[model samples]
Target: MSETIALSFEEIPYDWRVPGTYVEVRPSYTNLGVLGFPARALLIGQQLAAGTATPATPYRITRLDQAKRLFGAGSVAAAMAEAFLAANTTSDLTMIGLADPGDGVAASGSLTLSGTPGASGVLALYIAGRRVPVTVAAGAALNDIAAAIRAAIAADPDLPVTASGTLATVTLTAKHAGAVGNQIDVRLNRLPGEATPPGLAVAITPLSGGAGAPDVGAALAAIAAEWYTDIAVAWTDSANLLALTSELAARYAAMGRLDAHAYAGLAGSFGQLAAAGAALNSPHLTLIGARASPSPPWAWAAALCGVATFHLANDPARQLRSLALPGIAAPAQADRFTPTEQDLLLRDGISTFDVARDGAVRLSRVITTYQTSPLAVEDTAWLDVMVPKTLSRIRYDWSGYVSLTYARHKLADDGSPAAEHAEAVVTPRQMHGAWAARCKLYERQGWIEDAERTVAESVFQRSASDRNRLEARQKVRVIGNLMVLAAMLQFEA
Candidate 1:
């Protein structure tokens, strides 16, 4: 009934007949009279999930500090991440070359403004990639020309590389090679005991090649590592775990019970064992805990349970909970079997517990068999039973289907039942509330066609839209409202 809380009575057409004059037949159903999932059931469900051994700690996300610790301080990767975060996206360096008279080119030898040679004894230096003229020294020798060029480069490594010997003419190379003006700096290194490195009219030219920036692979890797580590820590926090547990429990509460298919739908995995659940009309419930990797022993056990095949250690203890009553329809009948919270207890006297079961537990398996006899056929109407099983664990496969077992019941020395009993059970993953919520959103967005299409596709594909569907619909609604508002304003005007 809780599950159908949102479903309108109009949606479910029911037949009614009047046998007595006092009351109308089924006078307007009272909101389905649906009860929220019982707290015991949820406790049992959580217990079922907790039955298995705790999961091995999950792999933590990488952290900046952790990465630094692993890689080292001031390492290439670390530095890259630190510095590259601020790298300019648009700025670039350009290289250009200058040609001078020393590269087997003639110098215009005159202080004259025009083509008058030998007029004023002025030596003209030819620098490439520019129209400006550089004047020769007043009494400069060939060496002084080369020396001046060297001095220019020594001042700035960003200067283009230039050479001026006959065999190795004054050619300047850029630190970063590229097209003209792509150079960063040029340098002039002085050799030992040469009084003056010729300050020749050297042409400074930028080289073409290798002027691009460094790849950011290392930086990205460092950042990723840091991000993951932080995520891992947050995920493992106790507060977060408790909150998630409650949230997931509430989701299950929205649904009356967890069936195998529903569990698979919710958890987002469907392996062979999950398929096996589909094979049976009444598959077992499997409650899961801890977001762990698939290869753990508990996971294997969970998978086995999915197929009803977990090799439970022989539990010699005969401490099963009280058998449930079957075929009880009215609230009066249900009250007899529904024990108050104080009545249940663990062997250690712990009262707090959660219960989840594989199916509608109107009666115990034994009680069902007893009522199945031919003599009881008429009495055994369509009533269902509710049982309280203390489950300690549920296991799962890679596909997220659960398998489970109960803790061995404790017995008294005289073969009488002990004062306290521990019931072990496993419940199925109840991720359906989330999925159902999404399906509702998708339908609202007029994506019913897409929803059906996805359902027909593989299960994994169907799960892919769960998170995005709601957001997509919200976006659609926003746009639709805006359009309507604009149209209404236009019409008013």
Candidate 2:
């Protein structure tokens, strides 16, 4: 005999299932680097204040005094000003700066005054790029002439030096410390009168005492263990560039990050700069060079860094092209290259500047051929600036998606009906679907070529031996910038 239980007609049902779409969280990119500073900053080497581990937070600097404290007042300060101006030409931009507790060695020199002035005479002296004029009254004493010269030199802050003197000689001391002070040239114009100006016999001392190399190693170390999209030093020295490139590559490898790029300036003939770039043998480093000009070569490098940072930050997946650099001028040199010579430079992996039709100085195109070799066949398309950047962005995006998807789903390894259903959510098919979705976004934005076969080929797969492991491979096609054009016209009767 079995006992039967009666159930109520009305009943309530409860749902015990997880719901909603499990979307992934994406990380934003950070663009920052050291772009400008002067010869003085190099002399300071690398020093961080005690108890401080990293540079100050990245920000825009509006005052010269602030720049002077970080980079020192001189060519470095001027470079920063130019970078900021060019970067903010079309839109407002800010740059990151490093602070050091180091000091520079001020250069010192002196000029001796000889011959006396019979009647009113003029004495002219040139320092750096500024001219100082001292007027002597009839029968003026040497002390009076020295005083006038000191006042004139002191009035101009750009000279980077202060003037002091005794009764017959004037001494000039660099206002800032560094080896760059040694390059200052002093010229005393030849005067016409019995009271002649300082001649060859006048005896002028060249400025000296500047010392120290840029402490890039320390600066990089201070930035905290993180990823930086760009790292630039307003220096064009070969040794410095080499150090920076090596460090950047090693850091990227260790951290498993591939977004860092290094920029450097070199001063010489086109061939010389090209040779330097080849010797570097790094795709991570981009070299910009200009012919020897009166203006510092590093100035152009700083401007390029600023422009590159702005473009990369605003559009990480696009190429930088045809952007106008207002107030920026091409390097003026005595040995300007001919059209053929300029073409040769481009062939040797050097980027050139030109005056655009709109009257602005702009970059013609950006390229990187540091990996060219006879052993392996590679196309010039690999050297395009946007190609690698876009590829990196895609890789990062795909990686983020996979990590997030795995974190939210848990499935049993046992081959059971329930386990199989749960695994379906993250199976190879699902991964392919996610990849195709991302590719569609890229294609719609015109960054890559879109095709059904291409999307199908980019699917992800799981390794047969390792149930916990998955692999994905994708080929990205990039649209390059239009750099050159050729056309022919025909007339027929």
Candidate 3:
């Protein structure tokens, strides 16, 4: 027969008392109440040389304005952090900056001013929707006018491009060296009230011929030991995107259990985005597409992740429909996607957004790029972002509960000999009871549905291969959101 009573003390020894009424106190690790799992977000992008922060080093950012200081003003990393903070201020945020490639080519555009101004008026130069106004006097020299325009663009640190004027020609150079700089819009006027000054003929040459994308390998390697539940990726190139997806998938494995969801935006046409989306099969990545929007794709990426982190931290199963992305401009009315186009995007694994009548951009639906299983068959099991997020939450909480609770507990068979007041010796039946209790907690938290069914079907047994090991067959039905509704309205009886 086994000993009826045992005292397991990690620090205190039962061999020698040597004193009267000697006792020891130990901390309890039982988490009886609801577990709190707030998500942490990381923003990755290129940083300019002006920034003080070291390259590939992640910094925990608490203040919104800290980004502009740490990542340099007008930098991609700073912009992403700003946009994210504008959308959400509560979520834990971290940012890492990557320098532009050494051999990178900076995009350049030229505007030639000719024919002296006949009327004194203001000339508006809009770069990425920010206005740079230059006032020209009547009959001013063309060369002087060009110089004035160049100086105006140079004065603002926020502009994505730098300007230099020679004779009657002014050239604008992108601040960063990459293909992304090619999208820096250089236009005369965007609003109704803005117009080009009369008598000044301006020839526009679009910014082009930028190359050399920064390698995201260093950034990924730097965060290998760290855990980020939500990530915003700046580069949309195929190679960089694939790197992020692979890393996220690896993190989801049982060994690491450090799952993260990635969000990014692509600037392309309906057909282009659809083709790109159909080619990808991953539940860890989410992509949003847009065209004719002044804001760059990186801003969209950060904004979406920020909003998602803030809301999902509270409730992972809630739908993100109609949540407005703050400080993000919606695409023009004529450029917005049609109803049919939006539907097709959802099918192709591309996330879509809607522009309100008041010119606010809001999330329409957020889904993963996973469309099929390994056998190439259609599958909706991991369709939504909620699936992986909820699963990660459950795994974290349950793993902590079980590991700490059974750290030193001895396993035994049913009805085996044990101490009269034993709390450490656990049997298969007791293990099942713990599993059911956890499921009940999940049901009460609205994370899962039909707890009774899950409890009834679950079974626990000692491992056949190893007597010390315990295994279980468990199942859970995650709750679903209300996505669609239809109604029949009778006009007249």
TM-score of 2: 0.67
The alpha-carbon deviation from the true structure for residue 20 of candidate 3, after best TM-score superposition, in angstroms, is: 3.3
Candidates ranked, most accurate by TM-score first: 3, 2, 1
lDDT of 2 by residue, 1-493 (tens): 7544332111222342566544444432222121121111111122122212134344344554554454445444444555545454443333343433256566789988777666665666766534567677766677777788888887775555689878878898855455545545566552223333333125578677665444455555544465556554655455666677677667556265646666655557767876765565555666666663323344555566667766765555565667755545444334455567666665566666665555366776666535565455434654655665566556656666656455645433334444454432356665666667767766765667754567777756777788777666776677555666788888896
lDDT tens digits by residue: candidate 3, 1-493:
7655666777667687577666687657544755788689999988899988899999999885688788888788887888899899989999999999999999899998888778898898877657889998989999899989888987888778888869999998888999878767677766667666778898989788988888888899999999999999888788998898899999998897888999998877899899989988899999988876777788899999999998988888777999998878777778888989999999999999998877789999999999999999999899998898888888888887887688789888777766244667888888898888888988888989999998899889888888898888888899988888888978975
Q: In model 2, where do residues sit more than 4 Å from their true spots?
A: 1-64, 75-78, 89-153, 156-212, 251-255, 317-319, 326-329, 333-335, 356-360, 369-381, 403-406, 410-420, 451-453, 491-493
True-structure RMSD for candidate 2: 9.5
lDDT of 2 at 244: 71
Q: Is candidate 1 or 2 superior in TM-score?
A: 2
Candidate 1: C-alpha RMSD after superposition: 32.6
Candidate 1 per-residue lDDT over residues 334-450, each given as its tens digit: 222223321221111111112225221121121111122244333322111111111111111101221111122222222222222212211111122223334444344332334
TM-score on alpha carbons, each prediction: 0.19, 0.67, 0.91
lDDT, model 2: 0.55
Give the residue spans of candidate 1 off by over 4 A: 1-136, 157-169, 176-206, 209-219, 225-471, 476-493
Q: List the residue pairs that clash in candidate 2.
A: 37-76, 38-76, 104-177, 105-177, 105-178, 106-177, 178-210, 179-210, 179-211
